[model samples]
Target: MRRITVPIALLALLGSAVPAAAAQAAPPPSIAWTACDPAEEVPEGVLCATLEVPVDWSRPGGPTIELALAKRPATDPSRRIGSLLINPGGPGGSGVDFAYFSGSAFSPAVTDRFDIVGFDPRGQARSHVVNCDSDLIGAQYTQLYPDNRAEYADLRATNRALALSCRELSGPLVTYVDTASVARDMDAIRAGLGEKRISYYGVSYGTMIGQQYAELFPSRIRALALDSNMDHAQNIAGYQKWESLAMEGSFRQFTSWCDRTEACALHERGALAYFDELYARAEAGELNPDGQPLPPEDLVNIVFGYMYNPNSWFELADTLLYLGQGDGGQTGRGEPVPNGYLPVMCSDFHFDVGAYPVLRAIEQAQNRLAPHTRLNPLAWSDLASCQNWPWKVTNPPHRLRASAELPPILLANSRWDVATPYEWGTSLASQLPSARFLTYDGVGHGTYWRSDCARAAIDTYLVELRTPAKGTHCPAVFPSSPVSAQAVPTVVDPLPQLTGPFRR
Candidate 1:
């Protein structure tokens, strides 16, 4: 699951278009956005504002970047607590927008009690997007069972294509995508709002932002809930290693779900057989209803895309049902699938256009880490993009550990999340002596959105400032149904010709 930091997405555009001086100067008494007609699509209570912060804090007198801010006044102004920040996960994702869109995403209590705030960290959507040249999507390496040198060569060409694409479109911000800048922006936002302290909820990459924010401004934090925690404490290599294993485990659970579900397509005991066959079909240029060739990884991406939300689980099952049935027909999958997932999946994490070779080497390194495990397409894409990206190593070996003095944080994780494994949750949470780790025996990525237990625990923390006992690690509590119980079952001809079931 390639989650973006929703610091932008959830907030949308809420705050006012004030002069940049406010960010450089002291904050206003309370947050407010310019009055405009709120559209049906926009959140009702959202207010838009801008925070003028130094583009480079080191050069305070230098040029400034507009830090987007969105605020939703406390549901009950009489009981308004304070500005509560929300981030939706992608470092590249939107957070400022979450303030506008997170109405229902947050638990009822959190929304009712605190004034929600979100912002796009610099270099993300609506906050100052960074780009490079070339169509990284078309140039990406597409090896099905990337087994031999021949496949690697083909992958190389595609990787090169990706590099050229990202490089051409990118400018100065490419080198400034580091999280420190984002943390600084958060501080500026707090200043702009005249808040002594900040409250935050971050997921996926958002957790990394939260950790950095908390670490940098320990005294500035009122409360924080970081879900699907990012391991800034670990090296990028280690991060990818753990994520690979996580993907393997999650895919296994996915297969198991297929076996148990009446709606899933691969019902046999060894669903791997069916998967192999399906990939082979795609390699031979299978077409879906959209008349586009369905690459194997494309198939994987569609399935991987929705693993973040239980709301999307049935959609995945439905897709699988079609894939299983479509593979049987001559036109491949008869109907189109994944129109929405493809664009973002293809273009979102694109690498720089010139660093094609770098992308290839990065992928090579990542794939070598777990030669036998299932790898997330997005996971590999990150490494590839980083390799080709113009960004430099400011905190490349980002090993910022949580401080012992911070208040107890509640860390949540899904055992079957391909993006963040349970190990990461416990591992990082362990570093923060004040933190209490919670696990859910669920599939897909992230907390909340679908899991009630996670939402309840997080909401309680956000609203009540209560948490699981210190060092009180909760066992993995999954939905009552087995992982695969909700998946549908179908009979697809297994590939008997396939060798020892492919490891990945």
Candidate 2:
């Protein structure tokens, strides 16, 4: 997961509209591939290219932007099917990085048959990035949990300032980074590759992109594998209740693991109770050994970040134990503000927080629903960050209208996913005309990475156009031995580190 610093500033800057370039008839794009940049350290066989597309699809002959693309060619070209476009779900996540670094995460069955192509969606990563003043972005973090109307108003002003800064610095592209635009960009990529149809593998936020693509161009997709699905039909209330419930469920899973596993640092001491004590200390302004104050939100974020993967539960236990003993360590510091998170989210979903009373009521409801974790930090952050966003909701929440002719889409989700809830996968499945939902009875955000059964199902669907039977469920898989301090698994997925809530 990419971690970016968001610093808040009070400067005001006026944004200018993008100037239209020379008018030309819209034509199918083509790529001129070259060797991967040495600095990127992409695997030996990967090639890189860029596709130039219009900033606004409505004005096909308008200002243009270049999207970064990376491809790992199929190892066995004799059996190669086609390009399998992959996305690792940070609205801000780098597809180029995922393709470069985590291509090995795919099963050999997939790797041997399809070229793994990853692209940084418009305004993400190597694409024309959306940037704002760091100080302006950082200021909003302090108001994530406002106490009164005055604080809430301050939060709104800060959010407005951040949006204005992004507009001024990033230009018109800031207004067009919604998932719908990215979905259109995906088709442009397909056209550039000269492919009649493209298969897709999207996780977390990427699932939203995949869904929008399938909706807009159903006939253009050969297959789609969406893991840890996003429900585009949710309103603000649905986001709050379901996201918080999912986090709470994951927290319960962790506590249950501690109860049965002797290797858990807090097994002897009650894990939930110890976490409560830490939260109390944080709220009371207790300083860690390093003398930095651990705010309650920071403490919650630390735990939420670790909850993405079961293997990281051991690290989380150790970190909490250290914090309890007055050792601040690395995890004590709060996550940096999420840059480029608000624009896409605010543009895509309408968050009608309304007046402070309404916001306060929402907070109270979240607290009641999730007393243990307080709330999903990512969910609350998304709500708070979009308070005074300058952009309009270009793609607001609604039930998906997928084409009946669309190929069968494969959806997977863990039973206890902390980010995208399992209900979202099922909900999305119901929305699509032809979709099969695969349940991973496990405890992680991305089911494909955690369950071999999920990976096999997805691979078969992508390579052979075979869907798993309806209501397919993969049994949970846990480490044979309890996780010890020295045995904590390395987290390869970057979604957890990204600040946005839906990042898988």
Estimate the TM-score of every prediction. 0.74, 0.89
Candidate 1 lDDT tens digits, 296-338: 5677666666555443444555666577566331321122111
Candidate 1's TM-score reads 0.74
Model 1 weakest 10-residue run by lDDT:
495-504
Question: Can you give the lDDT of residue 123 in candidate 2?
Answer: 85
Q: Please list the C-alpha lDDT of all candidates, in the order they appear.
A: 0.59, 0.80
Residue 352 CA displacement from its true place in model 1, Å: 12
For 1-504, candidate 2 gives per-residue lDDT tens digits of 122211111000001133233112233446778998887667888999987776876665568888999998999999899989989887898888777764557777888888888899888878988888777655777778899999999999988988887877778888999998899888878877878889999999999999999888888899999999989899898888988999888898888888788888899998988888888888889847466888888888888887777877877888888888875422222332336667899998988577999999998999899998878988888898899787789988899998887988899999988789888878888898699889999888888768778888988998899999988899986653443323523324555443245454
Query: What are the candidates' C-alpha RMSDs?
Result: 9.8, 7.7
